[model samples]
Each structure stands twice: as C-alpha cells, then as structure tokens.
Target: MRLSGGNGDERSAGAAQGRTEAPAAAIAVTDLVKAYGPVRAVDGISFSVPRGAIVGLLGGNGAGKTTTIAMIMGLTLPTTGTARVLGSDMARERHRALHRINFQSPYVEMPLRLTIRQNLTVFGQLYGVRPLRERIDELAASLDLTALLDRPSGKLSAGQKTRVALAKALINAPDVLLLDEPTASLDPDTADWVRTRLEVYRRERGAAILLASHNMPEVERLCDDVIMMRAGRIVDRGAPADLISRYGRDNMEDVFLDVARGRGQGAVT
Candidate 1:
C-alpha cells in the first residue's frame, strides 16, 4: 500500500529552483558536543543527512552513538554547538519540528499492561493523526502486527516488539526518522522485510533517515553514506563502497574492523 504522504511536488519545486536554491539538509549537526561532568560523550562532530537519504551511524559501545542520537532528538541538551532538524534548532525549537519526526529503538518499551493497539492509539492521538483508527490499522497490517494488536505489549516476543516499535515510529508518517538497530531481534527474513519497508517509506515520503547500527551488512545495504564514530568523534565517513575501496577491504565488515582497530586510513584514534 502507498504510505501516508508524498513529497513529489516539493521535489518538483526544488528542481525548478535550480542549483542556487538547493533545499536545506533535513538533519544538520555542527560542532555538536555533549558532556557529563568531565566526560564528553560527543565531541565537536558535524554532519548532515539530506532528504530522501539514509545515513548510517556506526560505532562500538561507549562510542557516543546513543548520546548523539539523544541530542539530535532533543532528549538531551548539548553542551555546545547545534543540531537542526528541518530548519528548526533542535535544542531550542524542537517542538516546532517534533510533530514531523519520530524515533525508534528496540530498547524502548511500552507499558506492560497496555495492548499494542492501545499503545499505538496513545501515540497516534499525541501526534494528532487524523482518522486515528485507520492509521493504526494501516500500520498494523503493513508491519504484520494485525494478529498481535490486542496482545499486551510487554508479553510480545522480542521480534514482535521490534515491529511494534516500528509501527509506532511510522504512525505519523514522519518526515525525519531516527532508528537505532531497527531490525534487532528479528530473524533474517523478518529483518530483510523491515529494511524493505524502511526503503519504501523513505521513497514515498522523501524522508531523511539517521540509522545507528553495528550490523555492517545492513549498513552497506541500506545507507547512502556511513558515518563512523569512535570515542565521541567521527573517525571516518563515506559511502560503503567508497570506504571499502579506500581501505582496500572486500566489504564493509572489514572496513569497520579496520577503523575500530585503528588499522587503516581512517583508523580510530
């Protein structure tokens, strides 16, 4: 089925404006920093994700990925610098843009006693989605959650919860999506299905996606560009194939390894 919205006319208008009137990046970070006491979780990093693009954020544990995502989502205040989403400063004006963005992560949980349908209803209402029941039904069917809609959210299996999280994220047909390990806990086939749905969403909405994942193959498959983070800093970034060639590696996995171990051109420091 077609997604909730489309940006075709916006794209046409942008094209008509020519090179001098390029659209603003859907997500932009400039010298962004977040610190806790003496610890810097993210340090002076900058990047942009254009509309209709999927950009992967890759890093190991304690590498600042979660903190960075939090700051971008306006859940955490940055120590310095800026994060802008759709032309609004996330720190000071996130409310203006929050309705147009959504985030998903397997780690977030819904109330144990709430049914999946109930949870979706609450979120849909919060987002002011018109015809809420129809939107919920659409997402349930698309995410294969129709059979489990009345199940208590906490009782669902890990894979089921992941799908529910995705449905929640898409309830408002967000223009910007932030995903953390989007396919986690699912079987290979299910994971592939989820990726395909994400691709469709991006294409249908001209959305910008910022994905954080340790799955090298998934990153290689879904991302237009990959940003590598290590110790609160970006050590490398490029298209998967370009990074592979630059590091003389056969695939993204090896390239990731090289960076993580400080072995190649864009080695960790």
Candidate 2:
C-alpha cells in the first residue's frame, strides 16, 4: 500500500501545532510539492525536525529525496508550498536562514585547488561566523583535519574528503544541518567515528539535523525519528523503535524494507 497525503500523521509536534504557532522548530516543511513537467518529484510532502533531534530521510533512488533536500537548501524552487528553516521562508527569505543552515554532501565536491583550511575558511566567511580563524582551527582539530589543513582538497582520499566535507558543514555551527550520504563511502571504522561525532555535536549544541542516507544501521543508531519516503511521498514515520514494533520487524532495515516494497495498506496512523 502506498502512503499518501500530507504529513498530518508524520509531522513533528511543532508542525502539528500549526504554523502560526510553529514552535521554534529547526526545520518545518508544510504541504511541500515539487514537479518536473510530467513528473511529480516530490508530491505534497510535509515534515519537521525539532530542536536537537536527528531525523532520517530514507528511500531508494528517484524517491524524491534529492529534490526535497534541494528545496530545503533553497537550491531549487518548489512547485508549491513552503519550507522554513529556523522559521525563515526558504523560497523568499532564504538569507535569514542561510547563515544558520549548512549542508554536507560527498556528491557535491569542494574546490579541488583549495586547501582544507582554505575551503573551510571560505564557507565560514560566507556564513559570517564570528572569529572566523578561531572557528576553523576549532573544527580542524575537532574533525581530525589538523594534519590535512595544508593539503589540497583534491589530493585527499575519498574518506579524507568526507571528513573535510563534514568539517566544512560544521564551520558555521549551524542550528540546522542537512547531510546527504554522510557515511556513503567510508569504511566501518570511519563511518562509526562520523556517527559518534554527529551524536556528540547534537547533544552539545542542541542542533537539528536532517540526515539523508541509505545506511540503515547508521539511521537506527543516530536518529531519534525516521521518515520513510517512496515515490515522493512520506509512507511511514515514527521513532525507529516504534516503526520496528509496528511493522513487526526486528530492526530498522527490515521496517524500511516493508515500507519500500509497499507491503500493507493505511500505513499512516
């Protein structure tokens, strides 16, 4: 059974409370829709990420995950509906949200010629992060980029690039962080390290994070909630453990399997 309709069931508490009173959520997307001529890439999707929560956006290829991310980041215009980051309308008032929001994606590579320090410094300046030099040093040390600070970004290995990308993402210490395939190509140890660092960041900073990933175990480990999308619509959403119990599955991977394969009817509560 395909999951249809907007996010009445899947919306966070702040979203459920109504936009007028939209409670200081980290991100809020309401009745959001996107289309490409004959294809509806994202169809009436709505969801939110509350303060300090890590929410996963999970789906297979062409499930509209990319488009959705693009919308929130203000890279693409939505066909209709609003997406607010830190209460600023993304489509029209992006400047207000831009400073407090950052995205990290391996697919979106940085300037190869720039050194690790150079790349991060550029982004930090763009966000107007105060005491920029101090912030870069702080991130370099925290993300283990101290040794690579002088190395050209393009000269680094894939895993090294991933780590640098993460450092760039956190340069501004954004209140809202969007990550796509964060651990996609990392080995087991590095991926685990990245996950642990993310957990620590959220706990200490109370930041809201939207993680778009295919790694099921990673999702189960870090996310406080999971929003499953299929064919551009949210099909199932709840805490990872709740979804597992509801679907009678042993883990998030199995629950994801059931939703992706369209196993049952009326998936939303």
Candidate 3:
C-alpha cells in the first residue's frame, strides 16, 4: 500500500525551524521524487536535519528509505524537486556540497586489502582532511578503533568493522552525516559504545545526522525526531515519543508495527 500524500511540505516546515543564526539546515529535501520503471521510489518525500540533530529514517524494506538517502548523498538523481546539503543545491553543486557530507553504510565495502589505519588515511586524504594522522588518531580513539587500526578492514569482526566505518565517516568532520544501518552487525555493548560516540560528536560539533535503521530502540535512544515511511511514501512522522502517543502505543516498535501493518488512521491499507 502507498500513502496518499507526501512529506515534502512537512519537511520544508521542519527545515525552516532551525535557528536563524545557524547555517541553513545541514540537510533539506523539498518535494523530492524519484521513480524507476513504473514504481515511484521516493514519492515526493521530504525532511530536514537541523544542525546537530539526530533524525531517524524508519521503514520496512522497499519503502524508499535507501533511495532517499542515496538522493540526499548525491549518489542518485531525483526525478523531481530538490535536495540541499549545507544550504547549497545538491543538483547544481554536488561536489562542493558533498564535501560537507559523509556517509557510512554497513552494506558498503571498504577496501579489503587495506589495513584499517591505511584505509582511513586514504579516505581522509581523499576528503582533504588536514593533519590526517592526528585526525585518524582522534577518531580511532573515540570509536574504540585504536586496537584494530592495523588489522585489515576485511579481516576485522563485524563490530570492529562497524566502528571503522563510523570512523571513516567522521574523517571529513562533515556537517552532515548519513548513516545506514550503522549498528546492524554490532552486539549490544559495542552498539551502545557507538551510539555514545555519535551522541558526543553531535553534541560537540553540532553535526546533523540522518540515520536509516530498523532498530527501534536505537532510533528512540538517539533520534530527536523520526520519519516513518511505507511503500515509498512517508505516512507519519514526529518525535518518537509523540509518534508513540499519537498511535496509542507504549513504544516506537509498536507504532512502527501499526504503521507497517497498515493500521494507522488515514494510512493506506
């Protein structure tokens, strides 16, 4: 089932809520649309990540979450509308704008032959990070990757690799961070550590984060706001608590279940 309306306007309004003195939202999608063959991959979806806020993108598979993130990252073009990264039109100035953003996805592979430290150094240089060694040390320490730095990225355990992936994403000191299933392979303890590091980074740097994950607990624990999508369209969105309250549930998982099952009011069934 598909939602009737899109989230374009809702996202624009949210983006405009950022403080007047701050850089426009770190990320903004306005009336964004993308289609493939007969399916609308992203059906006029929209949202904004205010500086320093952690926003969760929650949905079942094939719901356009990945496609949306790809568009925001300039990895794919939108069929209609626009997306801006750090206040610049992505379509017009993708390279200049993308430099201010970095992404980490568990599904993406880092170079297998490169040692963890070597991989990070390569990416750091590619992003033009100055004092690359010092920055690598800092990220390694924070993500608990100092011990694994010398191990080949492909040889590390799932949790260790996840940490390295996060460190790579932070190498650029980006204003916007896109995380897709960041903690998917992590155990509870390691996942908690990763979450703590991310929280600290956002608090200290005021970076805007867009996280796409199915982990309801992670979303509730980290995100200040949540956008719920289904069948390639946004059906409901709000603060996690607000979504739970609105849906008459005690937790976000329940709310997610309700929406996913097509039970929410005005939602397509």
Candidate 1, residue 86: the lDDT equals 92
List, residue by residue over 143-190, the lDDT tens digit for candidate 1. Answer: 999999999998998778888888999999999999998987789988
Task: Find the candidate with the highest TM-score and give its number.
Answer: 2
lDDT of 3 by residue, 43-100 (tens): 9876667777888988999999999898888888999988888878787778887768
lDDT of each: 0.84, 0.84, 0.82
Runs in model 1 deviating more than 4 A are 1-19, 267-269
User: What value does the lDDT take at residue 232 in candidate 1?
Assistant: 89
Per-residue error for 33 in candidate 3, Å, reads: 1.0
Residue range 31-58, candidate 2, lDDT tens digits: 8889889898998888778888898999
